[model samples]
Target: MKFALTLVSGLLFNSIAQAGVGTELVADGFERPVWVGAPDSVKGKIWVMEQAGTVWIVDLKTGKKAEEPFLKIVPKVERKGNEQGLLGLAFAPDFAESGRYYVNYNEKGGETQIVRFVTEDGKTTDPDSGETIFQYDQPYANHNGGWLDFGPDGLLYVATGDGGSANDPKNLSQDLGSPLGKLLRLDVTGKEGYKPAEGNAFAGVDGALPEIHAFGLRNPWRCSFDAETGDFWIGDVGQNAWEEINVVKGNKTGGLNFGWRLREGDIKTPGRKGKEIGGKIPENYHAPIYVYAHGSGGTQGLSVTGGYVYRGSAVPDLKGRYIFADYQNPRIWSLREKGGKSTDFQDHTKALQPDGGRISLISSFGEDASGELYITDLTGPVYKIVEK
Candidate 1:
């Protein structure tokens, strides 16, 4: 039986006073999974990334994990304890036809690289077949960035973390010279591998790769595009305080500096302030639509995880809600953005995954062709978000 349209629960369903949320464990029992992807093009396979450098394709129809993997890059990944191994994956726009897909992982020396390839039943190729679309050197481990996604503009977008190690020692996020801690957009349609789209900010610049769309972000963990508006929502994880989520228009300006190591949330960078070198304050920096104080245990297990805007017909109350999660604590939160007033949805979080960690490291949310949403627990499980 096909399970894409069916709703299944993991834990025993506990009906609470909450009106619209449904809870369950759709798929469980696997290894240390990190990221998840289920393109509308692929019918039954729910792709998951294992921290040990392997990809598992789970068939929603059978609820059975594929014995073979869609891709594996163990030989190239560094199995460091906190942050290493295969991290993110994305199927090409023509994946069903071309069978091509992409992944972002930490290589042997711990550098992050975006590699693309073609897949048949369940396997990926090497450097010869899959070229390195982009590569950046990593100073230390931990924040290597998150998933790869194709924006509404049809360009492949990548999110890279600030050069790791406590604060941004390199201040790479603010430096346009470096690609670290930035969001890159590239035209992967034609040309050999990847190229900056024509209208990209630095498209004509001599030295810069046109793909550099926006720079100065500190580990934009998970980002998404609204189906109706095409606006991009970015969840940039904070250092000590303030986890932020910013939404920008489809045709907005690039070169946005998200003030890392310099400014966390709206607060000014300590010591250095006012017109100093590398100390330019973001007077009009795109402020996050929503800001959560890091002090709450909410950010404990709480690295920010991006979720989808509820556009599915299943839940009317959640129709325009922006659902997100904190990785550390695994708590799910929602924000309702309407008429310029962004009201925090506190009722829903208490409703779904109340205890948190029902799914750990809630990496990324998946939407099927029909626009229904699915949540991937970092530890090898997938759940469909249903409304009671």
Candidate 2:
């Protein structure tokens, strides 16, 4: 049942610190916190999402979580499976003014729902205010890709996993008809229900889902946009042999295919080795910018957890470099992409280890209003990236 996690032992477990980079404890005591983010309109506070269906506000200065959750929908959420539950939250780009925000969760009926609501104050929302912007039934429980955010273009972007099960029995990643295993773009800006963003890759195309901007993603656990360049980044978890980091630079994000069940980190997946995509395979599939094989110690890791390009003033040395890590092997590292190549790779694991606690099982990474980065540990603590 815990197949994905049980295979985490393959990453190299080196604890070497690279110097100049570390992490400071921001808050602790969260229950399986899957996400943490700051609304640009809000200052010095962050919202944390617990997998059990509660989003709480935490004061950055005191590390104190509010006595009451900012939002709670536990009874309607289904967490029976290891990967199911309330998994993501994002404040609208204009949240400071409109009081509107969104949440992505698994409803009790086995559908992954993306809902919109309004909060008069920064702290809370009415349980009955939820308006479903989108909902889809998941074929299986495991790989429900649950990350969503507003891209630099101000449109909502969502990630969904292939209808789960080993080797993607349905082959949804390569299918144009199914929404699962794809990056979707939607316009939630109007007064009415949502619409596929005007330029989504498959909009108006025959047979393909209108919201699909890119296809062939297995399970993108975390993704972010670079603050300065607006480049899109993804940490797509691989099936058996590898974990990869993918990117679409300069905001040119439409119609790309991130080879998934067909290929895992540039290699044919063991289960899909002989299968072809009905045409030439390599020409259209976008390869990962960087990929680490599951191996003994060092940079090898299982379950890649993608992070942001450091843009915070607090870590000047890290500026412009992308920070990422592994959930199972638990190491931190950074690299720079220049001229379409990943350079300057450095391991920050030893340096990022919290003085009083450990950064085990990193569920997701966060970016605050100031562009500083934070990491959420499924075990509890949230740590902020900082200069050592």
Candidate 3:
């Protein structure tokens, strides 16, 4: 499916009300569902990734999950940490012919691995067919950024978190040599070793890894491209006080710093104290488009879950509005940006309530082939956003 980029004008907060938005239960009995996606070849089938190392296909028409998993590798995955497991999945844009898909997961030894697999049949994958693309040793377990996506340019984009620990102790986010804490774009179409995509900012720069597309990210738990505009959106998890949502124009390539340990969500964070040669904040950094505090007060949120901009016709009011949520608070919000700044925002949690009850631990948000939105809860069950 192809989408055209169009700028929306005259959009006001009062005109786009949240009352028309709601959630409908689609599937249940999932184990720590973290990511969800759909292949372009499949019309109504949605592929869901469970953190415990399994993938399931759900038929939207019947609202039933396939009894047999699409893929399973529990024995090879390590799920000891709250964030570890089979983290991400993305289907090749030419999946109809190639039958290829990619996954990012933590290996049994706590190392991160990106692998490509092929489906023997149309519906399922052979466990032995996985071909390792690359693997990296993770210094800590907590912030393994897990998101795989195919950009409109036909390249694979990978999100990696800073090597875990409080406040990025090793200052890895700013280190150009390390792959951790960076967004990478690779030409995965080749069968052998991967190559950095053309126009990468650090392609031939000295002391910089060629694969680094963008750096200085803490834990970009979830990120997606706007199907309509091709612009990139990222939800970078914060340290203690704030959560941020960042946007990179679709035309820009790389060398964009997101200000991780130096500045967390527009506030200059204190430098590492009581240590030898504490880290210095870089002068060049990109601030998030929008940010919210982490607290019990009104409009405060915890752990931003990056989501998609509604381009589906089902929700007319949501068109062009970016829908996202808080993993800790379970509240959903819609943000409208104009001229690279947020213009309107609304809390839609109450509108999404099916029984005056909130959906808890929203792990991820997904977009279907038709552009409709779906969300997965870590507790269990998947819900589709619909007209109330």
Candidate 3 per-residue lDDT over residues 248-354, each given as its tens digit: 87836478888877777767664555544223456657778888777644356668888988888987878999998888877788888788887677778777866
Better of 2 and 3 by lDDT: 2
lDDT of each: 0.68, 0.84, 0.82
Q: Which stretches of candidate 1 lie over 4 Å from their true place?
A: 1-18, 121-128, 204-209, 251-253, 270-280, 297-302, 339-341, 354-357
The numbered model that scores best in lDDT is 2
lDDT of 3 at 39: 84
Off by over 4 Å in 2: 1-16, 272-283
Tens-place lDDT per residue, model 2, 42-94, is: 87998999998999999999999998889999998999888899987878999
Q: Which stretches of candidate 3 lie over 4 Å from their true place?
A: 1-17, 271-284
TM-score on alpha carbons, each prediction = 0.86, 0.93, 0.93
**Which residue pairs in candidate 3 have backbone atoms (N, alpha carbon, C) closer than 3 angstroms, thus clashing?**
none
User: How close to the true structure is residue 239 of candidate 3, measured as C-alpha lDDT?
Assistant: 79
**Count of clashing residue pairs in every prediction:** 8, 2, 0
Q: What is the lDDT of residue 21 in candidate 3?
A: 80
